[model samples]
Target: MRNKIKKWMRKVCFPISVTVCLLMIGMTVKAQESTSVKKGIFAGDIDLSGMSEAEARQAVTDYVEGLKETEITLLASGDTEVAVTAGDLGITWANPELVSEALEVGTRGNVIERYKVLKDLEHDNLVYPIQISFNLQMISDILLEKCVQYDVQAVDATLTRENGEFQVVEGKTGYTLDVETSIDKVNKFLTEEWDHTACTIALDVDVTEPRGKAEELAQVKDVLGTFTTSYASSGSNRSQNVSNGANLINGTLLYPGDEFSAYESVAPFTKANGYYMAGSYMNGKVVDSLGGGICQVSTTLYNAVLLAELEVTERFNHSMIVTYVDPSADAAIAEGSKDFKFVNNLEYPVYIEGSTSNKHITFTIYGKETRASDREVRYESKVLEVNQPPADIIYPDPGQPIGYIVYDSAHVGYKAQLWKVVLEGGKEVSRTQVNSSSYKMVPRSATVGTATADPAAYEEIMAAIGTGSVDHVKNVIAILTAQAQAPVESPEIGDE
Candidate 1:
């Protein structure tokens, strides 16, 4: 019985001893792992010595968050290898592959002399660089690439001499290019140049497509016929000159987009141009000229050009608007500054027909027939305000002493505001305000003073005031006022 009891005790004692040994081994391993833990060199660990406090904190945060590791293998340098291990000198440890990748991506690196040789060794390698989370850099690069894509629409004025005849690109060839291709290309360039603005492209005028020859020709004919019947006058002095001027303009060539100069194309002031030169109305008076009434010719042409719907490159109003044409409708030519210019917008050549008749001057543009929309142009003049002339000076005639009354006085100059209203199809569309030309009132040069009074001086005084010479008027007033209190006509010999 004693031996059996001892055997059972031994078996239990052996099992307990084995269990205690196992527990001791496990505790030893756990303690070792806790004391020598291996972690990767993260961005947060990078020391920023010179940075401001705020910068230092930001740098640390950005570094740790942005850090990444990659796998890499180094050549064995010596028998005593500085193994990649945690808590070892001249060694960095992380996930093996991650550490290698970090190095390849220009991240953590060995600083000691022992590891210097590893950097020069050439070998097949692969790794990933650490990247920041902000996508601004990536977005900027992509957007820059997109900026090159110019998408815009505009008219291209490419003039290539293809043949002897000069043909506009919009016509003859029908080279209508869309903005998506070429204009957009320019737009892209502009987009890069002007980052803050949108792109806009304008087509050349010819590219806007003027009417075809035949269509424009018909409209010109209609306008000429209407103008001849409506506005021509056969006054005694200007008879036959109007219609003849219109006949001269027919079959006159006007090229597309070309400017037509009236003074140059029409007959010179010489009688050879078929118009007689004589004294004609000029600045509210008569002036002698080779083509004294040529203004009527110019005025008629102005109306016709307006009817054709062509662009006016240059135009001017006469010093005083003509009565034949509405105030705004009259165009005056000043050698270089102003001129009546009309572009031949028709696709085909246009001819002008100008002539003068017993009663009126007429102008017509002839061309190949074309179809055009029916449009009528009309003008209405409205008087906005009338300004009376400055009070006329009732001068005591130099001949008559002071206190003499002259019932009749010459009219002075007056000014007014007028508006030119343009109507299309009976609908008021445009209004242009114009200062009505000031008209000088005719001066009365009556002899009220002594019969011996200087007639020439009196006439000169009247002329000065009529011409609106403010200084002269004031001087005359002063002289008259001083004389007013002096004396009555010397009581001729009859003796008062």
Candidate 2:
């Protein structure tokens, strides 16, 4: 029985073990090969198997850059010529990560599967789809400019008299081409696998009827909510900013679902737009900047929208508290980074009437009344926690006499919650939380004089500091000035 078993093992198990050993060795070689791309891998016309990742990326970028010079001719009037540059068509590389794919040629999947893929690459050349994308909107805009100039819209015959002037005009169907079809054709051409440096394409001729006159203005009725804020303390430039921003938002109509963006409406705050240099907080210090005080207009508008029950989409608090509005009630706006937005929630369209007069900014929201006319809406701020600012920072001033001290403003930090309250006939109905606000405190600053000065003034100033009251430093300066201006003895002239 032992001899029979040994014979069976020699015949079957020996061959199976040898086959398994050779397979393991093959897999080991294939795993090392994964560090580099397989032999038959290529990205477009360029072989990427031996090239490094960075080299492959540069090659792909150069290929796309080469496409930028491709001349695309637009055929017009069936024969006339208009040449379009690749850039004008917004042709640019879309999938830049294709280079990474080439470097990872045989590295994907499990061990055995990866080995199978690497083995297959020895004979088979795998090609991926080359992707080129263009900005559809940019293409549309470019085509629109050309179409408006080269083609005319269809017009129907009409007779009209305006201010005792009568006119009769003949109408004819006009040949027009739309940007939609042009955009589609351009996209298809851009996605073509091979780079055709020079291509010819033509816009199709389509017919359309045109409208005659402008639409009438839609009037808004009913006052939804109104709010007014006083900015009397703000100086001329800042005050003007508030008024300018308010005027920009005036008479603006928003449909039921329209979102109002305060920043978008009142941007480009250049001196040309009547914005003036005013002090604003930047990097923890007050610095002069344009459109410094227009945030007051946005804050007032925000409160008005909230009162009108509009859906608040976005709102932000200032880094520090402002005196115009209470904590958690103010809405702050900075161009591009921060914005205040709200959506009209009423069934009918809403109109904004904003105006500023006598240092006061007001926003009145008018819409179809869904809530009761007597409904009272207001916000109450709830303080959560008080935070202590960091230790005071000291700055040395050589221009001031030694021991002179000047104090900068101190900031207090707090966390507060804003609640929106709804009342009916002076009775509370519903109270909902609007937002939680956190005010960051900027540490108080002191500028200490370090310059050498008269001995009398210096001694008195030092005494004031040692006693814990630097406020007397200025008084010492006053006394020292009086002594210097006193009458001098005649003997001093003889000694000199």
Candidate 3:
């Protein structure tokens, strides 16, 4: 019974093994036969030795028409799919005889030879279309190459203008390519679409300038040409020595707390300053110098500033009183030494306009008219204390003949203190102690000498010895003469 079972097993197992070996041999043979297959599009040749160039090309075109409807697809698993639509796929066959005829007849190749015309006809017009259809993956690769090559190209588009200037804009320039499109590949891929296209690229024209938030603050207000001044004169001069005119206008208007300076605004008189040199007060006498005639302009401007009730920023006095104005009313200015300055105490902008003619000089203050007005100034003087004149004695010497000298000090004068006060609403709002002045009591010295020593010379000697003022000698004489004539009236009252 065991031998019989073993025999049955050998028969079944041996036949089964032999059948499996045969099937394996068949599969290996099939793989070997397909290994040499080169799958791609195919182009055919047409004989057209007798045909013209146009006729040859036309025959190629007619042949390519047959392959237009062909479609090809690629699969991810090394499998392929193909569909041919007779209406769409095209085919073309090259005329080899025409190429051979040209090679034989021509010494040098023509345009046809340069382009490899016959081969190109089959390759570009016929085989290229067939390859793109039958070899779906090759179609995708070729389209990708076209897209990279034609990513940027020149074309035309419309331009529109809106604002200040024109410009140009960049646009997307690219070609479309097919990647994967097959029933078998579509099942395995995330997306399957063969979109092959020749694209048109262009540049967008921008016809406008940017204009949104670009403005300056200076353009909003019109305050360019407003200004002011105080007085007018020729070149810089002291007192009446300055003849007034446009070239001599002095004293600038202050914009609120603005500071003022004589030399800063008024240019110095020189040949470059367009002025004729004039005499200036020096040592109580006139001396010729550039800019010597401009001080009268400063004094006039000072008076106007006082009348306007502006704040005095800086002030100084002249060495001697000017004849054009009283001693108490004069104002002086010297570059880098003394200055006459005033600030606008008023609220609005002030413009100063001044002109001088032959007889008088005038300065006009211009601004927005308001209810505020200038304060009126008045001064009154009274004697505070008086000192008697000193006794004069003449000295005689042989070397220096008979001569006289006078002694005068501030102590030998009438001492007086003055006050300046401001009033508003009929009441004094402020008061200031202005000055403690002393008018000296002059002495008279009579000299009896040789005729060679003139009395004038003796008088000058006395003036030089004392205060160098004739007014002092004249005051003493007047006091003595008045006392001799009217013993009751005092010289102080006469002065008042």
Candidate 4:
């Protein structure tokens, strides 16, 4: 019985030992083959079977490089499209370790387990999907640089006047790229959603709707207020400036809560902008400057705006008194300093119509009238303080002859206020102060000449200027004129 048991043990133990030895040898072979990826393995569609780690890496890199030129189109409104490439977004292989991961596929487990894995690969591929990386900031930068050009800017609806009729101009919609969100979308598509082939992706875009539709602007038909100012006394150049400024401001449409800038509407003050040198008040004196008479246009618009009951956002009084409008009623705009701005506070849009005819500039504010027909409004100029001008001012002009003289009349200074009176059904209901102003007292100024060929006559004119009297200067000028006109002795000529 002992011998028979020994024989059975030997038979079992020998087979077990042989099997263990064969398993150890098989594992050793798999370890040796670990330098290369297992058979039937793939990185995406590129076959990596029996390929070394370096070769597999190179293959994957080549695949990524080949995909670098894939076309990606960015689209925007107005049929705007921009084409870009994957390389522009800084694409690269994300996981290089996956190549090594692929190499260890059948070599990692015990001999039987490794055999089972290799057997499984015979029927089903052992695919280590190719993962990629993208520079997110690079993607954003590309969209900003290349794709931003396709963005459309929203345009506001406006109005135009033709043949004394108001015409409506339509607005356009705008589209802009959403860069950050678009980057995320592109990254996700490339990493998980994309099939790694030539494909198109629509980027994230934002839509903007324009303001002031035609239906909204059609309500601006009733005339809310109107004002006119005369420029008959202005010279040809000054009158042209007035007309030019009025034309620039004509047919302007202002929606509710919109502010109008008088200076910005007609600016640059250059000859290119249709302005000419004309007289304007400066340093208590009249000086010639470009766009000099444009203040009259703003003043006219201001009165009309006041009558329309619009909100005044910014306003400035002129440095000196102006003859076109009463004190405390004028609006002035200067370069870099003063501006006249008003807001359309009503519920509907307002259309400004400006025109110049027969030496008069007129501004009319048209909008939907909400006030009762029985309501009446009027503006009154009130004088608070009167200041008399000082003695006449004299300036010497070296460019003119001794008898040449020019004078400017004095202007009296005043502290004045404008009042807005509202009446309902022929009864006064409200009286409010609209604005207040202070005018400087400018003395009568004279430019007198002292230039002469005769030193004696020049000295005489200087002496008259020292006396500070125009009569003295006139007397000296008369004497010089009489002397110059006196006939020379004729006896020499007769003898000849």
lDDT (tens digit, per residue) of candidate 3 on 174-265: 22222333222422221123332221212122223221111211111212122223333433443233443334453233344555555455
User: Which candidate ranks first by lDDT, i.e. highest?
Assistant: 4
* 289-316 per-residue lDDT for model 2 (tens digits): 9988878989999989887889999999
lDDT of 1 by residue, 287-373 (tens): 556555555666677666655555556665564435575455565553445466777776655556566554556665554445333
**Shift in Å, residue 445, candidate 2:** 1.7
What's the alpha carbon RMSD for model 3? 27.4
The number of clashing residue pairs in model 4 is 0
Q: What is residue 461's positional error in candidate 4, in angstroms? A: 1.7
lDDT of each: 0.44, 0.74, 0.43, 0.87
True-structure RMSD, every candidate: 19.2, 19.8, 27.4, 3.0
* Candidate 3's TM-score: 0.33
What is the TM-score of each predicted model, taking all chains together? 0.37, 0.56, 0.33, 0.90
lDDT of 4 by residue, 1-496 (tens): 9999999999999999999987777865556565878778889899998898889999999999988998776664444677778888888998889898898887767677777787788899977788888889988888788777788888888888788677888998888888888889888887788776666777888888999878888887899999999999989999999999999998888888999999999998999999999988888878899988999999999999999999999999887788989899999999999999999899999999999999999999999999999999999999999889887777899999888988777889989999999999999999999998998888887889878899988888888888877667778889988998899976545554
Q: List the residue pairs that clash in candidate 4.
A: none
**Total residue pair clashes for candidate 1:** 52
lDDT (Cα, 0-100) at 39 in candidate 2: 70
Candidate achieving higher lDDT, 2 or 3: 2
User: How badly does each model clash, as a count of residue pairs?
Assistant: 52, 0, 28, 0
